[model samples]
Target: MTILSNNSQVTYSGTGRRKKSIARVKLTPGSGKLIINGLPGETYLQFSPNYLRISYSPLHILGLSNEYDIYIKTEGGGLTGQANAIRLGIARALCTINPENRTALKSEGFLTRDGRVKERKKYGLRKARKAPQYSKR
Candidate 1:
């Protein structure tokens, strides 16, 4: 995470990854507004409440949902992965804002980086671990 100050306004930034998705998030003091990839977050997320909820979970936990504007640039994987990545990024940025926030975020598991990813498909396998059918002659 990094912190940038411009004209007395502080901006906190963080990077997060989930599965194949990556999200770069910035937090600045402003009314609640979420922007993703230059588009309104709701539009980019297809207006899915679940996705919105996941992305905003950390802020809600800290009771600062409307205290900062979230700007995100995300790519890869799918909506689920991207949302999760955003969540982590937001959590990290919030921590930078205040060290005390870390304990709360960590207890809720927001600080945890999800390491699960798709397994590689083996050469002779139909899928990651699926095998072709065998039959007796």
Candidate 2:
């Protein structure tokens, strides 16, 4: 059976996390161009090109891509974090857009959110799990 039925269209959602920050993204199909919260990133360059390399959505969103279209809204993260989140969100949304993509996306590990974070410092130590230097007097 196909992952997505013919002409299937669904909303895509995903959460992105990066070093002490988190982001959420929502994606939807549009007319041959990406539109993000009504803002055109092409003129403003709201995000770095490294992040934009993820897909044609943002490029189209910024009116830079020749084909493919999407709209995205992201919140709760730094620039890099937001980009990653948006990437994952877009990947997931792609699955929603066409379930046939889910397997490939999942295999590429694009659907998983990075959950690593700084560990809490210990009360009696100089840092997390680090003990004070001892000097015998």
Candidate 3:
């Protein structure tokens, strides 16, 4: 986590990863607004309520959704992965803002980094584990 001060306003930042996605998030005191990669969060996420909801769940959980602005730069994954990464990043930044927020975030499982990822495909198999069709005929 890092802190940046611009015009005397403090910004809290955090990085989060999920699968192949990485999200760098900044939290600043402002009306609730979400911006991702220079675009409105909803527009960038294709207006999918699910994605928006997932990305903002941490703040909503703490009843702080309207207290901060979320700015994020995310890349390298599908929407689901990116949304999750953003959620984790937001949770982490909130923790930095207030150490006391950690317990609440953790209890809600927002602080946990999901470790599941795509399994590597084997040399002679389809996908990660599907085998070729039998040749008994």
Candidate 4:
């Protein structure tokens, strides 16, 4: 993704994806308050603590979790996918603030985009690869 905005304010903006989820992330200097889809991050992702942890890992890794506010508008997938996508978005946005951050994010594998997705089912198959058993008669 690319920086959608930058200047004196609105420090950075970036997009991130995982599976089918897409996250639009905005980074600003402030007390770390993460908001998702207009809801507080903790409230929006309360389904699992893991979701919170995954989405916050990048900031935690950089030791800037409390220095920047993260706002995410994510859609197109389940909570797990959205969480991961947001994680990537945060890492990428951080890169804009400091190019050196790329090394740390890359070293931590946060910059690598996951390419695995659900396989399409073939005609006559029960699922992606399962097939019906033939009758011997």
- Candidate 1 structure quality by residue, lDDT tens digits, 38-96: 99999999999999999999999999989999999999999999999999999999999
Model 3, range 53-129, lDDT digits (tens) per residue? Answer: 99999998899989999999999989999999999999999999999999999999999999999999998998899
lDDT string, candidate 2, 1-137, tens digits = 11232467544565556665454544434455555556664432365676566534433333434534555565554566666666666666566556677676777777777776679998999899999889999
What stretches of model 2 exceed 4 Å from their correct place? 1-24, 31-38, 42-47, 55-68, 125-137
Q: Ten-residue segment with the worst summed lDDT in candidate 1?
A: 1-10
**Whole-structure CA lDDT of model 1:** 0.94
True-structure lDDT of candidate 2: 0.57
- Model 2: weakest 10-residue lDDT segment is 55-64
Off by over 4 Å in 4: 1-8
- Give the whole-model CA lDDT for all candidates, comma-separated: 0.94, 0.57, 0.94, 0.89
Better of 1 and 2 by lDDT: 1
On a 0 to 100 scale, what is the lDDT of residue 22 in model 4?
Answer: 98
Clashing pairs in 3: none
Candidate 4 TM-score, true structure as reference: 0.91
Instruction: Please give the range of 10 consecutive residues that has the lowest summed lDDT in model 3.
Output: 1-10
> What are the runs in model 1 whose C-alpha is more than 4 Å off?
5-8
